[model samples]
Target: MLGAGSLRQQWPPAGKLHGATARGAGRGEPVVDRELSIERPDGSRIDVLLNITPLRDHAGGIAGAVNIVQDITARKRVEDELRASEQRFRTLANTVPVLIWQNDEDARNVFVNQYYLDFTGKTFEDVMGVRWHELVHPDDAPAYIADYMDAVRTRRPWRNLDRLLRRDGQWRWFDNYAQPLFAPDGSYAGHVGASLDITDAVLAEQALKETDRRKDEFLAVLAHELRNPLAPISNAVHLLRHPDGRRRADRLVEMLGRQVRQMIKLVDDLLEISRITRDKIELHRQPLLLADIVHGAVETSRPLIDQQHHHLEVRLPEEPLTLNADSVRLTQVLANLLNNAAKYTDQGGTIDLEARRDGTEVEIAVRDNGIGIPAGNLPAVFDMFTQAHRAAGRGQGGLGIGLAMVRSLVQMHGGTVEAKSAGAGSGSEFVVRLPLAEPPDEAHDGTAAGAGAAPLAGQRILVVDDNQDAADTLAMLLDADGAQARAVYDGPSALAALPALRPHTVLLDLGMPDMDGLEVARRIRADPAWSGVRIVALTGWGQESDRERTRGAGFDFHLTKPVDLTVLHAWLGTRH
Candidate 1:
């Protein structure tokens, strides 16, 4: 309410007031003004200003006192309200979850919330006028302070991720943001700061980015590896057709066959990687002799061993050790390891494959004296797309999927694999352990063993492929073995030749562009005239699914190219 009364009623005593005025009648005296609060009759409050003056005669003697009173309750009430608002704001700032702080125009602490004080384990008094930098992580404080000052000078909102020293004496990450504060008149006041813990979120994001980076690297490496062999194979094909081929034909064909085999293995590894990662690859389990699989792996990797002129020593238990495993897949596992050993070892280096029976499991180890794995990389060697260190001048041809597939296949069969290396030049070893099989009534079938092909004379054979060089070369090889052979370019042409040629066997390439080998085989099998003809599928794809597809399409034999000449001839001899 507004002041409604006169000053005369609120004055001190009347006689005193009159005396003060009488004393000041003849003299000029300074005036003193003071504000005071008083209670009204209804218990309400009002404020007023009182002006007092002393009057003196010309002789300089006080004669009377003069008092002037003014009502000023509104100003006092506005001041009270301002103080109350500030108190409530402090309460709010203290109750929030994040750390909060503020600094004045000169960068002096105006306030720090209870939460911030709690984190620093300091009382409000301890840090009342102190800078906030003391609580920042030692490693991050310099950058933090620089950024803080930059924002202050530019009057810009700023945010950063950094660690702070917490009350428990440990550093923890937080995302902090600060905005400049200004007074009503647009004068610089201070900055308001808030910080929230974001350690986990940042870690998760970093991990995701790393995974994506590795995946991209893997794809690039795979493409480079796959393309390497293709260049040599393509060149070899051209070389085989050159006029000088008559003199160098054997050499060219051998090199071409090696590269084709390399490419097939690469394709198989790519497919196997997908299957292993998705847990889709299956193992066909059976009881087998451990020596048999070891021998197969050794034989498969011998060419590389011989090429490098490495001295290889094999040691196996004198007694026949048995294990239950998928024969084909088990052979693949050991062969991949042995090939890796040969590839990494220097020429004429010593390599050893040793097997032993320990308790309920068999340990097959492939050890080589060559460039070994780096210590830090051993743990990740069996991870998909991971490989041994590549030397500056040595370019080993591989997609880096072999060891990963080996581990996956081994684990699928209830076994484990491990890698060991002294360091980069100290050589390396890989050990695979499989659960042993109990004694069985019958020994393993010797189908996985090697054999030579018997000669078949005057038997008619047809080779069909989209690649002219492949078909022509296969036909020539067969013709050289005393069999009458003819080459066709595609499925349609092969089918066209069947009626007149009446071949005993058709070596069909499954990946032809038009009228695929499968369709051609189906048509040939449906006819009554070619009842005695045997169809063999030759293709680059050798995954279990590819074999299943050919088997379903009426192929009597499924052989992945570049097939061993001995194996191909043996199958042909059987057909004859």
Candidate 2:
């Protein structure tokens, strides 16, 4: 119903349609297919296509124009909707954290999200047409490409883990997962994929596996080391029971003592490592002279040095050097290093202990011309349960916790320790650095104040333990030290014997059947008649909390079992 006259009336004078109409009328030609927008009386607009042509009169001259219009509103509306949807999709893809991508049917990347571009440091054009594959690590590209091509051919989901090179030139692990994309007509449209960074997770899993492996190795080594001491002790015991044992009794007894001491040392190292891991070991720090500490450590490791026949040298600073540290623990740390050097060195090898002030810190170094540590092991030398490889036929006995304990103890005292070596066959040195302290207000005599006195000569002492052997041996030791000692096998027997013996001191073990040491201590403290007796806890429980518990239960002293005879004698000497 849109005639030429009506169309002319509706259109503006300067409109494209008017120009086309005038040109068609004057030239007597046709203006075909020009698009125009038409507004209705109701204020609604629609798109239309216009065609104008000139009509000829009988005189062969131009006349008015004839116009034809076609509606194209639906097609235009669909185009706008598609453009907006594409914009929305691009915004969503760019906003995510993971790498998002799309590919064509030929497996060429056609579109990639902003994250993908940023990760690879490439533009859209640079990444298109399989150029993104350049970012895949060379080690991972071949398999990745093959797997992707297979997925594309089968039009199936795919997943893979591979390393990709970042813009910074670092290769990081990624978990790539993709699903096959298809058109509305069910034709293959390549794939839509996402890649997530999994570098941290991969590294953590690897470390966990390594730790588990080390734990298994440590367990196996511990079993072998424990069995080593048992064999010697067993042999000595058999020899002592022989018919002619008394003639060779002294030598066999000495061998037995040495084996027992070795086992006790191994157990002590294990306990110390446990304490360090739990952060439970407390340091009783004091102001002490470095010379004294060195002397004590040398004494402690002397027997081992002699056994190994390693010549030891000691070097100290000309001026006295003092440090604020736990005297006992510091001595133990140096002793462990010395023992390590002695055990690893060959017979007649020279070992050196040197102490000197380096600026504000004192450096104590133990150096040995023994089998050196491999360069690879130098970094892990202080790690728990780690040991340097030794030459065959020169196997040394240890639990590999000594250096670990040394590191922990030094760190506790605000110090640092380091192991240094050129490489295998170049010898090794362990250096400990501690902060120097101001000299004490008064000079220290460098001697134990009340030590070296004869032990209790006539004091009555009671030894109580569930292990009969432990109780009898302790009583025998006490009697040798001139104490009237009696052995009781349990806490009840200990409590019953106290009235008859009226002992001045009671050495009680904490772990017993029926009545524990705490109950016995409490009952003994409750009795007014036994109030003056000093009750000492002798057990394997040596933690700080264990000491606190015993103190609360009325124990005057606490001693860890396989008690040091010298320490027990010192306490007994104080009783007089």
Candidate 3:
């Protein structure tokens, strides 16, 4: 089998092998010459394996050997594919963002991706097969281990848990999940897990709950504070008009009416603040005379100004200033400003109410010479329930909701209100500036406006209230108007005397305890005998919804307390 020439060529080439082949070739053993791929002159590749065996006569000895050649291209291609597959797996494990890890049933980490290593700032030597507990929060580690053991015993897939520290010394909230790996025979092999961060979500949920709790507490206190005066005020109006009461019951009725009106105003201001905060103000705008609305407000506040001994000076322009506004709401704004001036002023103080035009704007100012506002509280004066601190010393009786309403209503009119004062005890001034209206070409005159009529002249009427002086004074005022009148103490007695008295109309108070006005109206309406009777709701609950509710409950009309006897007489005239 020896081919001298070929053996010489192959033996020399194969002798160049390194490692085991080089040593073997140094010995007298056979040298297996394997050919790898080689590029030919035509640019094509061919693989060939050449084998050279030692030639000997009897004993093995070095000699010229025959060479055998075989093509091995297919086997080389298979080896190349195995190397590529191994590289792809390493690329995926190192580049993926997820923390990919594997652990045994004992919760010892066996394999980890490079990302997991980077996240924990650990080296393979420091982390491989390390117990997972060492990386968990000390407080949470025991519970996590107990849960993991339970899951393993039941052969369940791992789920979420909030774990803590990593090797980086940072506490993190992670959602840890793992899947059990099993062999073909269903035997446990290991587990793989991933940890995702969710700390923001947990904190946000807690924040929302805390906010809701505070809102509930605020509402509860507001309701209790608002309702304390309603019952007694209603009952006082009932008691003041007793049949056998003091001779000056009429005067007491006036005083009680003023107090009731004050309460209604307070409640209305609170509700308005609520509505404004919720952006629920719906305006009913129309062309109205600002002068007329302001005049009416001034007249309504005259009683309070008189009681406070404040000198009221009103200066209105001779010409009427007409603008597009909600008449009722505009009146409310003026009333609030006037009330504030009277409330804050000292006895015998002077208040100047003036309306003047400045080009496209009209400014209404209520200036008072009284206890002025301080510099610090001026900015927050329009904030709900924000009151100025007493200047060194002053009285506190108000709930501080009026100016807040004044500002809100003024803004709703597309206007602004500003409070100015030199300093405390130097007096304060509030200016309301609103956009002026374009003049109507057709001129209108207010010369035909009727003169003020006498208080109220009508048929005899009954005045019922629990307070003696209020009832008698109200009766006297009615009597002074050439109208016969009587006063009664309570709702039950008033109802008891209705047949004999045969009153034309009934003024019902809503907040009475033993017999509320709502119940009284219900009872009166229920009786077919009094089908023609008129029941007017007169109470301190002046909210719009409250008015609507009373109207729905069979009241002929809903009027707020501190009734204008002239308006009441007009209503009675129409009813009778």
Q: Which segments of candidate 3 are over 4 A away from where they belong? A: 1-262, 270-281, 316-320, 389-399, 421-423, 441-576
Per-candidate TM equals 0.55, 0.69, 0.39
In candidate 1, how many clashes are counted? Answer: 9
lDDT of each: 0.81, 0.84, 0.73
RMSD of each: 14.8, 10.1, 17.4
> After superposing candidate 1, which stretches have Cα over 4 Å from the reference?
1-140, 163-173, 183-189, 198-201, 204-216, 240-248, 315-324, 354-364, 433-576
Ranking by TM-score: 2, 1, 3
lDDT of 1 at 282: 53
Candidate 2 lDDT over 292-406, as tens digits, reads 9999999999998998888999999999998877778999999999988988888889999999999999999999998888888888989887888633344486867889899
lDDT tens digits, residues 1-576, model 3?
A: 234443434545553443323225655465666665777799999786666666644554435665566677787778778889878977887787767788877767888888778878888878787876777788888888888778777668987666557566887777888888888999987787877766677778776786576456446545654565666667666766777556657776777776787678667666777887776665556566878888888887888899999999989888788776767778888887887888888888899999998888889999998889888879877866556744345534455566777888889899999999988889999999998767643332112222123223445466666666766787787677556577776789778877887766676667766877777778888888888777777677877688778877798777666766645655654344
Better of 2 and 3 by TM-score: 2
lDDT of 1 at 202: 83
Decoy 2 TM-score against native: 0.69
In model 3, the Cα lDDT at residue 29 comes to: 67
lDDT of 3 at 515: 78
Worst 10-residue lDDT window for candidate 2 reads 443-452
Per-residue error for 391 in candidate 2, Å, reads: 8.0
Residue 309, candidate 3: Cα error in Å is 1.5
Candidate 1 on 120-230: residue-level lDDT in tens? 898989887778777788889898889888888888888987898888987879999888999999998988888997878988998889778778977888788778878
Best by TM-score: 2
